[model samples]
Target: MRFARAIALGAVTAVTGGLLAAVPAAAQATGAPAASAAATVSVTLTGKAVRADGRAVDEVGVFVVPAARWVDEDAAPVSTALVADNGRYSVTASVAAGSSLYVRVDDWTSSDGYMDRLFVGKGGKAAFTYVGLAPIAAKAGTIELGTATAPKLSTVRVTTSAPVHCAKLLRKNGTLAAMECDYTVDKKVFTFTGMYPGEYTVGAMWSSWTDARATVDVSAKKGVTTAAMLTLESPTTMTGVVQDTQGKALEGIAVWANGPDSPRTVTDATGRYAFKGLTAGSYVVDYSGASGMSSAYRDYVTRTSTVSVTSGRVTTAGSTLTKGAQVTGSVTPLAKETYGTIVALAADGHVLASDSYWSSDGKKRDFALHGLPTGTHTVVVQDAASGRYAKSTVVVSGTSARTVGALKPAAAPVTVRGTVEGTTAGFVSLRYGTSPLYRGAIDGGDVKPDGSYAITHVVPGIYALRSHRTTSTAGYEGNLLSVTVGDGVAVRRIPQPTRKVQTLQTLVRTSVTFDGRALPGVVPLPRRTPADLWGNWTNEKGVGQAPWTGRAWDAVVLEDVFFAYHSPYYFVVKSPTSVTKPGDLANVTVARVAGGPTV
Candidate 1:
């Protein structure tokens, strides 16, 4: 699986010195490779960004990164700047003036609000040119980069059968998008407006039934409206009673579905348990607390039962239990690099889909355990030699998608730093020790955008430097850096190696190893540490890396103002008390970030 990468060496005629007739690597989702062109020219793109309603955008991140980054996402920019106060942008980037390149914003902060990864110039179809552009002169100036119209929210209306109450909108990434949604009982429609462009699914309850597939896959394009109708055929329900050897009904026993997607509930006083809103599928149900049904049933340990459910149908697989108490649960991992990653469940299991089912967000990383009749049922999560953490613990609980959180690296608090490329912003980290790995970093404030960084409060030990940029691009490679702190010692700059983005994963998974003799997990930053996150954040799982904030480094979760999905994101308004609806917004204005917008 070699990824097609464009090496933009010292400004040349074409992106990679010259364009190759055939690319040996596979093109990524961002866009295609740049074609060849003469280096005899330079380009200066001038433009302004505005909303669909003709309002100017200012101070947004306006730059010329690699034209290939649009396709090969990990690629960083070569030249950068901000849109001016008057909504005008001028940048003379070093590109083969005639070659194809991309000019856009990586993250956007506009009048309505902020979008983490927004792209302008994606209008016309030249494929992935961000809406391809025309070539310019050898140093062309103010060539009208064109206006990027801010994307408006999409209204997705989900129609279900009858008065199916309670519908939720979740990001395709498996995170909740809208909570406690409002629905129209008469029309059986759950409508959510003010949505950004992305994929979403409906995770909600139907009338008297709960369904995993209550809605089809719905995509929202900016300024577009979409509707998905989920026809509830024959709704299905599975009901059965749990009993002891004496046939006495077992009460208060918890029956849980092995897959995190399924629902769980307690048996009734009559020892009866039921599951509703089920589609035809194989399910594993395990019980907790049944060792005491009666003297005759006291020695029985319940085995996991296999039940198959079909669309609009029910299947029951209940069992009688002797005396036994056990614990089990599901683990959900949250990143792309999270695939092939094995997770260690303390009792006796790892994240294997065939047994532990993968989730729908992307490639699912789900796992559960049965058989644990005795022992502390600690929900600890360990990585499969491929994840960032050597081991993580499931700290929070709740089986529902939004409520459940797990598989995060344990925190390590030592400090360390180095200059990988002495270039770009310092959005870097340092991970050390071995399994139960420790991830720590130098303060973002200590690391300059030029890449010069420093780490204080170091725990004397050996560590590894992991980065994605090359020396050519000003990044470091994975290698060992030893720190020895005497009673009173000054910190020194650790030497860096070459950075290879292509091999970053390999370094992350293979090349790097911890000193091992210490505690197993990620180290934390110095206390009172304030880091940076580029834009808005949804409820992300696990403390992890974030986009560079052009400022001091940050921790996993930071403090910020959050609003509800239905709440308006204001830029400027007539008066706080004067505006309440869309009509009231007609005359208000907002103060942009960094004096960003042109008044």
Candidate 2:
């Protein structure tokens, strides 16, 4: 997810009723003239960062950068800070005369993270970058340094109904302040300070625990106490076996189960399989061979069974495999052909057997395939020797043998023939919507020197096509195309889009690095501003917007906010970085208030 800076540029006007009566002489030394000398101007920046459930984010990182360098190389951040505990922050900066400002806020928690970028001034309206994260921006608001109130701190108690694994609780600004754990029988508790009155969410993890989650709200007048109960449930197990058509134990044959709330599991080496932690529900057991043999060899054996597990219980089921029929065919190359190919496909387009061999003396070639189920089959023959092919369907009975007579080579289509360009040479499948109807490569199609080619005899329907290129030189490979196939459809040449084009730009709060490599996760900022600086800054005056540095590849805006910043005129620079996992960083670049935009 991308992170962005929120920058608001407005004229700093004097407070009402002579609030700036003691305007210091040094104020002019920083380039801002006195109230009487020039228009007394003030900027206020304020906003909130919370989870999707409206819980206040604590200790998240936030920053503000100039609009010019939000996504560029030059305009790096100039101001940064951590948000307070209440998910609210305020910053007030007195800008010199005739200057513009940009503000940005970013959260780096794994859930509902966001990076927002906005500009404030007479120059232009604010622009947003929705890379992967979503940001909320506050509209124009008045700021009174003299009347603003400091953020109040309070305490919150979090309790779980049952004993949980007890990971660590984190603030929105990506800070690990303390280590908390409890091995008690029933519950665990944690208290936080310097938190403003607001809604906050706590996350906990536990093993063998079920239905354990909760939320709480805190306020200054009445400190909030939240509790979550953990429920314990027993897990059920399923065991089964697989065998071949001759009633012999088929070791290593893959077996799987699919059903409500059950993930797929593979059988063991002894052809025995077991599914653990299965909730009380109905499940379907599916068995197949490692080579993916067709139903003829008992390709798939499925049984639906229900098991009621009370705490701990073992359920057992057995499966058997049956024999299928055999199919034999011949590949005859045309006069000018060089190679003969034959493929036997099932009703569902599963390749049961396929083989390609060099033509001997340019004569007809014979091939045989065993272990096929009794059913209708689609046979594809390609005579690469003469650049010709044909497709036909045949039926085979489990008890009898089936044969396909000599297939006469057909004339290639001249008017409608094209090749798939910009893709590696692999299987280019074409299918017509929600149906089992489709055709592979064109049997008889004209050839062109260029990759451009077309096809004929296309039926009418909503046709969707895609190419699976075995080898791809660029990211544009494996492209998909959707088209409408009405009666006598003629598809002209369509060009594929390249991946080099960028549709959006995103800004991130903190740069992440893993094993000395940059990862893609934002660092959160605090939501509340400091108490000492309260009443001296408006929410809008202290708002920060980070600029888009031409670095990070893709941004993942976390849901929590912990970082904070003041002054909309500052900027932060970011470079494209990637991380393999989370919480793996050794070095990072952070800029605090050094010489610019101080009250």
Which candidate number has the best lDDT? 1
User: Compared with the true structure, what per-residue lDDT tens digits does model 2 show for residues 1-599?
Assistant: 22222222222211224111112224211332322344424555555444334445442222232211222211333444455666565655454332234433344442222212222222211222111111112123442211111122234455554344353333322222222455332235554433323223354544222222432222222123334232333336666776655666665444545544444544444566655556655665545542343323433322224444333566777577655555566766676437756666665454555666566576777766554567887666766644356666778776456777766445341233345565324333454332222223333232244555455544333444554332112223334466554444345454433434222222223443221222222332222221111111112112222223233323222221221221111112122233232221122332210111111
Measured by TM-score, the strongest candidate is 1
Range of the 10 consecutive residues with the lowest summed lDDT in candidate 2: 590-599
For all predicted structures, in order, the TM-scores are 0.35, 0.32
Model 2 segments beyond 4 Å from truth? 1-239, 245-247, 254-269, 274-290, 293-319, 334-341, 345-364, 383-387, 405-587, 590-599
Model 2 lDDT, residue 565, Cα: 27
TM-score of 1: 0.35
lDDT by candidate, in order shown: 0.39, 0.38
Please state every model's RMSD to the true fold in angstroms: 24.0, 18.6
Q: Give the Å shift of residue 242 in candidate 1.
A: 8.1
